[model samples]
Structures are given as structure tokens and as C-alpha cells.
Target: MFNGLSAFPLTPMNETGVDEQAFTRLVENLVLANVSSIGALGSTGSYAYLSRTERQRVAQIAVECAGEIPVMVSIGAVRTRDVLDLAEDAQQVGVKALLLPPMSYQKLTDEDVYSLYQAVTSNISVPLCVYDNPGTTHFEFNDELHGRIAHLPWVGSIKIPGVSVVPDEAKARVDRLRAVIPKHVTIGVSGDTLAATGLNAGCEAWYSVMGGLFPNTAKIMTDTALTGNAAEATRLSRRLEPLWALFRDCGGSLRVIATAAELRQFTTTPSLPLPLRTFTGETRQRIAAVIDELELS
Candidate 1:
């Protein structure tokens, strides 16, 4: 049921634990912006970094704040059993769907990946979405594996992160996946910078990080692209280029978005777990310049 921009918000954290007030505000912001769906605890949400209780709290808050908008909770974990447990917990909290990435400490084989999904889908009553984010999981899904995953019972959609830096090449990959995957299964694209090209390539939904902070802007771009308004979509994409560049230079969107959120006073500067650095002063200034230039602040 993820058909348009599904906002993947960063889980706002404070010293003690999840900043529940800030997290609720962020989710409410997405709903107010009318995002197609809310993806709680996705990569952007730092699912792996949070404890089970923290994640459950995040999911519950998102579902509570989302109102009519669907909430998709990421149930991915290093172990299949943990994934299944998360899936069950999500169901209890009235989650709309489960997003599972094939995660492992060591490299995983195709069969291993397939088995992990199979185990969860077989147990969970809710629909499951395959999240193939090679950048985070270090596991890639080939075309054959995609076809097989799409055929699995209860699997509804696949989130493919746009890997190619070239626009045409990224589109080509989306086209190829669309051709092979089951017609019933929707192909959603991630990678906010390439999202316009991906939507133009016929991806039905966008699993977006930027959308979490600026859903209205993302919705306009995706809607324009989906409706064949190429010129309008191109303009919107160009407008977002500076922010996208900061995302790349800062290493990821988590810190950049968190910093933006803090600047806007949406939330306090979150305390990320150790080993994950906050944005540098120079980077924050650059981000501030882009935000001001875009009139996002």
C-alpha cells in the first residue's frame, strides 16, 4: 500500500532515551504535510541503533500521531527470530506493514536472505516489504532474487535504493526491476537525490529521508514527475540539489536532517550513539545556508 512518498524520519534521541516529545512532533509534521505513508524505524530512523523498547515506543508514537496515514514499521534485525519478534510487536501496535532488510554481521548468501524473509512472512499476518539497501546491509539483491522475493507469500513491495549515480542508468535499473517483479508488487525507490529520476522511471513510491523533514516539497516533486510534468519535476529536483549535496558530503542524511530539525527548533540536537559523529560546524553552516536559500527555515 506504499504508493507515494513514504517519509522515513530520524528517531529523535536525547540523553536518557528516545525524545518522545520530539519524535511525536516529527511524526505529526509528516502527517500534517500529507505524506502518503510514514515509515517508522527505517534506515533513517536508526532502527539498529535503538533498543527493542525504544523502537516499540517509536512505532507506537508514529501510529498514534499518523491518524489516517498508514504507518510502516521496519522489522529488520540481525537475526530472523528478532525480526519476527519485531514484526509481531508491530502488528500489536497496529502497524500497516513490515519493512525487512536482509541484515547480517557476516555476508549473507541468496538462500540465507530468502530464508530470513520466508521465516518472517510465514509467521506475520501483516504484509512485508523487502528493503534492499546494500549500502547499510552489505547485501545486494540480484534480479533473480528479486523475482523470487516478490513471489513469496505476504510480500507486497520492494524498496530499491538507486545505486547508479547516472540518471539514465538508475532509470534503466528501475525499468528492469519493474519488468521482472510481479505486477502486484510495487517497486519503491530510495536515495533522495535520485528520487526524481526514479519516480520518472516509474517507481510507484519513494522511501524518502528528505521527505521526513520536507514532505510537502518531496510530494510536489514526486507528484509532478508521476503526472508526466517533467519540466516541473526537473525544477523541483534542481532546487533540492544543494541539500542533496550536503547529504553526500556529510556522509549521510541522518546528521544533516537532525541538524536541520534542531535549527528549525523542531527538536533539540539529538545525542547520537557513540562512533556516529554530529555534523561539523562548517557543514552545519553550509546546511544552514542551503536551508535559508531554500526558505526552509
Candidate 2:
């Protein structure tokens, strides 16, 4: 259930709150596109910016709309107790799995991280995916740590973010992780631009931002790579190069995806919190051009 393209839908927001209509439309679109699974309240979903009630609502909505497709919801929190509570909430809402990042305001030791997952897994009935996004969590995972976590009863997958900014090196990182981690545990990659590379390097699944809005394209790329159609996979990934460039230049994927969604008229410009804003006019124009070039609209 965890393996394959796990689409991370952007949480459509307005001044009032989450735009339920738009959010539903986004999930429905992924289902229509036939993505392997759906992920809500992920990094792309702006989980940290939302309230507890909002998160619950989002997870419920995702599960309701996803139907047969499994829904994995992020339940990362600064405190272990809070994480446990969120895990219970997610399970109650019918979420199939929980994605937990060892989030920390301060640096955490290996023991600290292990205990957090152990505590949640011991209590929760659902499977959990270890999200190792050092960029957001500021916590890194070593091979030994991954091995320990993978052996946990409830742990199903390990999401490893592409550490290298370069695509080739990022692909190498996926291969390295595959070699070190337990074979039973699926290795999922999160960097949108490095998805094809990661897949070609033996990563089992893609936790993708682009897949959220462009599931057909993402599925095609993943299938091609997994089937050993390297040429076609590379071709599909190259078509996304322009958008990927904009994603890198604009800081990250949250704003770039939101802007693209707005351009596609999928929703109103995503309402982000302070310290984060939508794209600039020039950036939007570039994104528009790429969208047109790829015929994504």
C-alpha cells in the first residue's frame, strides 16, 4: 500500500480557513489521475501552519475523498505526547498510515528520536513512515538509526529526502540508502526534482509535491523508471526541468506549486503564514510558461 507515487496535495487555503471545495477538488483530481496513494498534512500541506482542528478536518476530508486509495497523514509534532495524540486522531479519522518526522526546536540525539517513534508506535494501531527531512526537522538520520527504526513493529517505510542539490548525487544517495536500510522497509524519496533519479536508483516510492497537482505525469514517470524504460523516464523528467528550476530558484516547492495551482485556476492563491509568501510576478510568469510548455493545464 505504501509503495508507488504518494501524491501530497497542497492544502488550499483562504483568509477564512481551508477551502474545502478546492481541497476536495485537488484530492479528486489525484484519484482521477490514478495516483497510487494520497498524503495529507505533509510538508507541502503546511501541517505546521494549521491548528489542531484544521489538521483533523484536513485528514478526515482526505480519507473521505480518497476512497479506495490509502491516505497517509503527517502527525509530526515538537513533543512526543502531542505526536501520540495526533497519531490517535489520525487513526480515528480512518487514515491508513502516519508519517512522523522527528521535529525539534533544538537538536535531538539518536535516543531522543528513537523514543519518540517507539512511544507512538507502541500505542498506535496503524503503520508509520519515518520522515527524514533534515531541511525542515533539522534532524538527520544515520544508517544505524534507520535500521533501528525500520525494525519497529509499526514502521513501514522510511522517507529519505535527497540531500544533494544535484540530481545525480541525489540519485546516488537513494542508492546508498537502499543498500544500508533493511530490505523489508520501503525506501521512499521526497525531493520532487530528484524523483525520477531516485526511482531509477531503486527507491520504491515517491512522496511527491508535483504528483499532488500532476499525478498523471508523476505516475507515468514513476512507471517508466520502475519498468526500466530509462529513456522515457528521463524524457518525462526533462520536461519538468523548467518547473524544477523555478522551484529551486524560488526557495522551495510550497510557493511554486501554489502559484502553479493558482495559474491553473485550481484554487485562489494559497494563503500562507507570515515569513512565507507566494511567488513574484516574474516567477509566476516563468511558471506559467513552463506549465504551458508541458501542457499541464
Clashing pairs in 1: none
What is the lDDT, from 0 to 100, of the residue 206 in candidate 2? 90
The CA lDDT at 220 in model 1 is 87
> 1-297, model 2: which lDDT tens digit per residue?
678899999898865789888889899999898888898999989998788888999999999999999999999989998888888889999999999999988889999999998898899898889999998999988988888888888888999886464657866776676676667789888888878877777778999999998888889898888898867887888888988898889888989888888888778765555466778678778888888888772
For this target, which candidate reaches the highest lDDT against the unseen true structure? Answer: 2
Error of 1 at 210 (Å): 0.5
For all candidates in order, the CA lDDT equals: 0.85, 0.86
Q: For candidate 1, lDDT tens digit of each residue in 172-287?
A: 88878878788889989898988887887778998999888878888888889889886778778888889988888888788898888777777776546545656757877888
Give me the candidate number with maximum TM-score.
Answer: 1
